[model samples]
Target: MYRFLVPLACALSIAASATAAPRLVEPRLHIDKEHIGPARIALTFDACMGRVDMRILDVLLRERIPATIFVTARWLQHNRQAAATLLAHPDLFEIENHGAMHVPAVDYPTSIYGITAAGSPQAVAREVEGGAAAIVAAGAPQPRWFRGATARYTASSITEISRLGYKVAGYSINGDDGSLLGARAAEQRVAAARDGDVVIAHINQPSHAAGAGVAKGILALKKSGVHFVRLADTVAPHPTPVL
Candidate 1:
């Protein structure tokens, strides 16, 4: 009995040590390097709630610009018509998970504008799965990307996201339309985007001038020979882990 107890204690210690070690995350979510390409940029938007500024979306669709939209469950429910519209235009937009309730985590400390990170692994999965269900119900193909609330994601969350068979998305550039600095500044920000850059913006709260500016910038860039690509197409495929 004593021998067995001693071995059990040692095993527990080893297991705890292994768990304490830092987890591995995808390079794209944290790394800041670009590969060879034709200067492609993925324009993304986060639609949280209500009737969004369709004007911005209209521009993307009419211009045939490809984009990825990280949407929440609440947003889809509140704006089903708009959600359906986006779903119909598959060439212009790809729907991705942005969390369920967008609840911030208390156990871990992370922030974007002083907001906490999303909840635990299980909680995060629920958020992601829930949004995926909503998308499917609303007639959109399931999302392959997961962007955490506030865009503040941790290493653990990244591991969970990968385990759930979704890519962790982090932008290389921010157009800052959500920051609301007028359309001109927003256009300038988007114009500054380079090759292999993933530009982030918001279309949920469209009362600001910057969102409009972001749309304008994309068109202007197109006129100057900049081509837009869907984030799914731009991202490196996640390699399946060997068991």
Candidate 2:
């Protein structure tokens, strides 16, 4: 009986340690992604779900603008043609992980800005890994970066995700509020971007009026001489982890 209790105590100890969030060297941001070179801006699209924003993609492709795309498993399952289309333009885009179920990568099972987080550190890791595996199984290269649902993270969750070998992709600009925007608002949000800002917008809502705005903003940025780049070209993700 004593031996059984000892094992139980040890198990509880381990679980307790695992539940505690790690100390991060930095504070996490609502959108923490960085950008490219001096005159360059990184335009990142999040396909959270739904049909491809051909309105936005068309302009990017027509202009030969480079971009980074973050995709979820559900989005891939539902948008095969879109995935194939993106893969066809490898030079124009880098496909990265969004998560298996669009779960927020946070330390516990509470809502943040209406997002349901993964609840535990291990669950967060699974979300990151599952997203990567799904993307790889779909035939794209292994993703070097991940941005969880809502592009928000607790400092510890982001740190743990970084430890799993993917840089937690944060954005310098919220280009579209989850694709909820009017054309003018979307255009203003993105067009107002400064050099070196990693812009985060959506490619999941083609029917959304904001999609057209995203296109307009991209074109406006191009017209203003802002060069586009892939996240890879800017940051060599997977630096030595602080943890």
Candidate 1 local lDDT, 72-189, one digit each (tens): 8888888878887887887778898876666441124344456655445677677777877877777778788877665655566667777888886777667873546788898888
lDDT of each: 0.71, 0.83
Clash list (residue pairs), candidate 1: 39-195, 105-117
The alpha-carbon lDDT assigned to residue 30 of candidate 1 equals: 21
Candidate 1 ranges beyond 4 A from true positions: 1-38, 104-116, 235-243
- Please count the clashing residue pairs in each candidate, in the order shown: 2, 3
Candidate number achieving the greatest lDDT relative to the actual structure: 2
Each prediction's RMSD to truth = 7.2, 7.6
lDDT of 1: 0.71
After TM-score superposition, the amount by which residue 16's alpha carbon in candidate 2 deviates from its true location, in angstroms, is: 19
Q: For model 2, what is the error of residue 113's alpha carbon versus the real structure, in angstroms, after optimal superposition?
A: 3.0
Error of 2 at 140 (Å): 0.6
Residue 176 CA error for candidate 2 (Å)? 1.2
